[model samples]
Each structure stands twice: as structure tokens, then as C-alpha cells.
Target: MASYLAQEVQLARRHDEILSQRSVLLQQMETHLGDKKTEKTLQMLAADAAYKRNTALLNDIEAAEKRLQAGVHLQPHPNIVKIETLYWASVEESIPKWEQFLLGRAQTPVGFKKKKSSEYNISHAKVAAQR
Candidate 1:
């Protein structure tokens, strides 16, 4: 019984650690997503909201883990919380693609016709006549 309790406590501690890492990753993702300049302002706002939601979920997970550690008997489950997976899926893959797309679009050069200089200078002629 004592061993089982100790194992449970260890598991809860591990879960807390995982949750903390996940929270950090989510925060990073939110920061990155917030920094991006999207073509559609509405999409940027929506992305911001998504980042916030992910952050909030991570926080909730951490809080739940804390409650579980404080003598709260929560249902036991395997470690399904993955920080790396979430980071890669949400931020790592998308940021590079978006950045590349933006960069590619920006690289397109704009052409403008240069104004030709007149061989005859009317202003010079006027000045010469005044002199």
C-alpha cells in the first residue's frame, strides 16, 4: 500500500513536470504566433486567440496536476501530454512555412518606368536669355 502511494506520488510529480514543460512550449508558440504578420488581419487575430487557448489549456493542465498532488485522488492515466509534439505541430512547422511564403512574396520586384530626361532644357534657355 505504501509502495503504491509512493508510485502514485512519483507519477503525479512526473506529470507536473511534463505539464510545466508543455506550458513553456505553449507560451513560446503563442509568442511566435503573435509576432507573425498575416495577410489577413482577421486571420492574425484568430491565430492570436488560438495561441491563447493553447496557453490556457496548458495552465489548466498544470493546475489539475497540482490539485492531484495535493492529496486529491484523480483518475490515473498514462502520460499523454507531449510538449515537443505540440510545439512542432503548432509552431515549428507552421512558422517556417509562413515565413517562407511571406519572404517569397516580398522578393517579387516591382517594375517602374524611369522618367526620360529631355535633351533640350527650356529652363536653361530661359536663364540664358535673362542673363
Candidate 2:
């Protein structure tokens, strides 16, 4: 009976030790699982952000392409001739005056045809006053 009691005590102590070890293992597993879950969540968020950014960039590119296509399909200007006439008129008057002043002599001896009426000529004072 004495030997049996000693054996029972030893078994009880061993059972207690095993239970403590199991508790420690369970805590460690819980901590590891939590870390894994957090890591995966962060990875998923990063991927989602990247996907959204790429989608927006793609949308912008498509919009620009649409604008380019629309621009290409537009009709040509109807008053192209009138615009050219006006542009040349300004150039012919200004370019000769600029060249004459810079070279200290008139490059085109024939000169830019003067306006038919002096009233049409704009003086420096008149232009400055208008401004």
C-alpha cells in the first residue's frame, strides 16, 4: 500500500507538468496565428491600393486617348485663307521695319507698301495710349 501511494503521487506530478507544457504550447500557437493573420491583412491592403492606383492610371490614359481621337476627327478651319491674309499683312509690315532698324538700312529697297491712307498708320503714341 505504501509503494502504491508513492506511484500515484509521481503520476499526479507528471500529469500536472504535462498540462502546464500544453498550456504554454497553446499560447505560442495563438500568438503565431495572430501574427500570420495580421501579416496577411497588411499584404492584402497593399495589393488593393496598388490595384486601385493602376486602375485610375489606366482610366486617365484612356481618357487622353479619347480626346486625341476626337481632335483628329474635327473639321478643318473654314476661314483659313482670311487668317493667312491677316497673318501675312502683319508680318510684311513688322519684319521690314525690324530689319531696317537692326541693319541701319532698309533691306528691301522697294519697302513694305505704305498704307493707302495716313489715317490707317498707327503711331507709337497712339498704340501706347490704346494700351
TM-score of each: 0.28, 0.51
Give the candidate number with the greatest lDDT.
2
Worst 10 residues of 1 by lDDT: 106-115
Tens-place lDDT digits, model 2, residues 15-129: 9999999999999999999999999999999999999999999999999999999998996686986888899999887875687756876444455455555656556558888
* Each prediction's whole-model lDDT (CA): 0.75, 0.86
Model 1, 23-53: lDDT tens digits are: 9999998887876644467787899999999
Off by over 4 Å in 2: 74-131
lDDT of 1: 0.75
Residue 108, candidate 2: C-alpha displacement in angstroms: 42
Please give the TM-score that candidate 2 achieves against the real structure: 0.51
